[model samples]
Target: MHGEFWQLDNKNPDAKLYYKDHCIDYNELEAQVQQAVNSLPSERCLIALVAQSTLDFVIFYLAALRQSHVVLLIDAALAENDRNELLEHYQVNLLIEGNKIHSLSDYTHQLADELCLLLSTSGSTGSPKLVKLSKANLVANCSSINQFLPIIKDDVVMTFLPLSYSFGLSILHTHLAMGANIVLQSDSPMSADFWHNFEHYKVTSFYGVPLSYQLLNRLGLEKMPLGNVRYMAQAGGKLLARDWQLLSDYTHNNNIDFFVMYGQTEATARIAYLPAEYFSRQIGFIGKEIPGVELQLLDSEGERVEQFDSQGELCVRGSNIFGGYSETLVELSYFENIPLLHTGDIAIQSPSGLYQIVGRSKRICKIAGRRINLDELQSWLDALCQFEVVCVGSEDEIVVYSEQPIEAEVIKQLATKLKCHSRLIQTIVLEAIPRLSNSKVDYHALKQ
Candidate 1:
């Protein structure tokens, strides 16, 4: 089961996985995986795997991989309609959840032998599109990540994000690729038991998204005695500069490294990351591209942007870039002919040679004939106040929804900064911003 990473660990089969009170060694895990593989169908076909971070999930996923079956990883908590749509769209023949394997519709289309993994675009917005990742793509991504992070064999990681998420899946992949131990927890961070387990297991590292950091800030992470943690990472979505600075300061004072990474499902997992040494100077920058990947900014006309601080669509080229999206069984065999992926993200090249995101191309709006980026506005609001804001409206009006009330002065300041009339900006108070299951702001839901 170790494949390439566990070559020397065959004799040292110590506890490799810790879930609740049970411990599974490497030898036992391999045996269980083989047992699970024996029961899986031998024929090649696509299978839907509703993933949960459990011992069985690990075993079944590895078994399916070993059997050369393409696995479409879906969230177990997905709604039935969405689940059915995915099953029908992909023409998946097997549904593996927990101990049960239900046969679904038969798929006759020939899938590429290299295609081994399928994951929805993170924060999919209730779309049926799924990104098909090949085995080589996964291996290239893991190798590139290891080149910078240098995952230690004895590193113990505390799982928080769901395995269905790309960032979460990368955590599991990189750790396993380095022959590291994993501490699986199927509980929310809000629960007291979760922290107790974190302490009990002495987790050496942690990974989370922006929302996770906000919750940690609310809980006062500075007061918590997490001395055993060697490092922490932030990804999935952009964190406010203020919030990131807070965590960076805390981590620095405690002699722990903090990494700010940027990635997409199309690129398998990671693309660029800010090194710990330049964390302070780079502040909100996404830093340089990872090993084996090239990143550049391309203007709307397909020309590269050479001016610093000039916004353009971020583009990535690498072996990790996935083949293409699969919306139906026929598209499953489609391979990406385009060499460069134009990420919809709008970013700029800093004077220090780092990449800083400005906004998303799809999130931009023309307010009163003047282009306004909602993401940029949200970032400014995030730095100005503690409230969470989501900007949404048409070309005539810009509506801002906040978790807390906003003062008139703040609105006026925003209008002034945006070069728009005060009346054009409307503010609404909401208890919370609508978010997808993966913790990304659900703009579609917000509009509704």
Candidate 2:
């Protein structure tokens, strides 16, 4: 199966893409993809897949891959300015409007490795960086996932997240690689009848972020019968201990498996997935390395730390790992021959074969002449107020944002926990945290 889901069972009528009442079969999908691919100008140097949940989006994505044209997936929900800025950043050659495969005959030929995907970062620090992922990177990562999660023909996955994200791209690529069925939901999840699609479609698996977990909790998933659901994965931002514990308990109470995983845009999509079986026992850990991957912690000198509980930069080495970025190859500096993706995230390994995310070294700051991890402070603040919080740096001071009005005494207590004085603390109360389209805290916009 070198390409195009060579093993798809075309005869199955129930092989429908259950987007609400409409059922798009594998045969129809193949036809649509082929037709769309054939219709492309072929001259277009860069093709952008910019739709959300339409059949056109799915077909175009596969079509772009098959056509071997560098495809740039644009988020349909992105602000016009942001989208334009991204296109400018990547120098996109062509734009494909939603639901319409408008001919682009301006580009006469494909340039070598032009720009596959201009993936937008969370823009936590500033503007979202366009991580240019290539077709080679996509193919390698999709192949790598097959080593861990067997992409059997029987497998079915639901696209619950936005098509703009890397995880969403992975879902499309990996499932297509596995010849698995992809069930696209037409209705927005905000609608009351969203869960109906899940049930009606007989969705086998799902993936989402921390907010999705919070939403499920708020939606009251106590009695829903998800009969065909097999597994679910969560990543993106750092999942709180309380949230992770709740999910772990939920999966245990039921027989459903939950995979708490970790990765970044630099590594294609996923670098590690905590096995669902280990969910109950590990609880808060991000799990061992994924298949064909080596997860190691390197000291300041880039030497592997042997002792348990030793904190170091979480480095990843594997075939799924990308070579470099699109515009420039920022060769990851290392002290040894080991070429590891030096994830700025700091972690401490337990003897039990579990890795606990401590905090990012970049986020650590000096407050009141003492080093403090903002993540640590945020966790402590959340514990005190029993609500979500994020800590960011402003000059020499630390600013805290919370969902509800937090008492100054509580912040003083956090100072005590950090062994610091209260005068160095500043707290901001918000009714709710503002999130990016991808559900991450919009730090850049928040700074305004």
Candidate 3:
């Protein structure tokens, strides 16, 4: 399952992974992974891994791939009940965490030899539905990303997002595939230590979600001493237009590449990227498809939409498209023969031939017989206030959860702006928004 990256003659033997002060070379890392693989019972068994961005997780992940095992990557911070439920649902044979190995089930899911990875549809909320990714899916996506970003032996990326997340895992996959090193840190991106090590290690690039960029903006990106930082990438969610412009301006002024990427777990990692050269010009665009992917927009009735600025669901057909989802061992046999992926994102093709996300297909609700886009509502609230908020609702009412205390006037303003009855709006103040390990708001927890 693991490709032949070890055979590259140009791979720098001195180039190694940076975990704090520890540096592990490729030869040593390969040996460690081999030893771990040798100790495993057999290949092709489903292994559920509670992965943290640590050396242990990296080694074991490589080992599982080397053996062609289907490794389900789960967030290390998941609750025991949620974790065990996943193990049971998938009929996983082994559970690995650091040095501990616990055999979970006697049964093994006979998956296709091509299937090498499983990722949750939802972030750390533990949605039972799992996306089955083949080695071809991984290799194709990784190669496409490398063609654009062009990672080399000298490049060093900082680890911010959890390894369980597809985007996060792609950072590991692409960098390691190209023999570039990664500087791992278990601390928050806002932490003083994260920046300390970022500068200390001369990390060339770092990836972020909207929230991470928001925090960085508040911390004064222009003020930070990041002379060695070469590029900055934003994905996982749409960064607010204002914030995106701010970051882009700073990067441009400082001669740093800013990439706005779009992707989902179903496609392994990346689908499209707004290149650095288009950062200022292509304001709200997701840019063009990555090297091997073809993108299209389809209307609700499933017909292809070719008219410019007409909104429809974004569809992608590529070698990187994954196998069908798995809820049980039997479901593992299901593979998507059609490589097409309906991304469930409502997008419009701009006149310039770039796609812009307007909303999500599932992010709408009926309120008093009128459709309301919750994401649009959230974006409206975002533009109006500095508070972190999530909007969820039923057919008749809407609940807005604010991470900080908000004035009653703010609720009334939102209701007026959204043209909804103020009485139908309810607000809840939380110390912090309930978020998954990947920094996405946990809607499941919010509903609870």
The best candidate by lDDT is 3
List the lowest-lDDT window of 10 residues for candidate 2. Answer: 328-337
Candidate lDDT scores, in order, read 0.82, 0.69, 0.83
lDDT tens per residue, model 2, 164-281: 7777667776776666677775344556566776776577776778888777665655755467777777888767767777777777776778887788877778888777788877
Order of models, best lDDT first: 3, 1, 2
Model 3 lDDT, full chain set: 0.83
Cα lDDT over the full model 2: 0.69
TM-score-best of 2 and 3: 3
Output the lDDT of residue 123, model 2: 30
- Per-prediction RMSD in angstroms? 2.1, 4.0, 2.3
Return the clash pairs for model 2, or none. Answer: none
| Per-residue accuracy of model 3 over 357-382 as CA lDDT, tens digit each | 88888989887677888887887887
Lowest lDDT block of 10, candidate 1: 1-10
- Judged by whole-model lDDT over C-alpha atoms, candidate 1 comes out at 0.82
Q: Each candidate's TM vs. the true structure?
A: 0.95, 0.88, 0.93
In candidate 3, which residue ranges exceed 4 Å CA deviation? 1-10, 404-413
Q: Report the Cα lDDT for residue 98, model 3.
A: 82
Which is the better candidate, 1 or 2, if ranked by TM-score?
1
Give a tens-digit lDDT track for model 1, residues 1-448: 3323322245345548887777887778788888888989988878888788888788788888878888999886688887887787777889999868899977575887678888987454446788888877888888888888846777788787888888888888888767678887767677798788888888888788988888888888876648788888888888877778788888889998888899998998899999988887687788899999999999999999999999899999998899888777777776665589888999999888889998999988887688888888888887787657778868888998988888888998988898889999988887788887678887778787
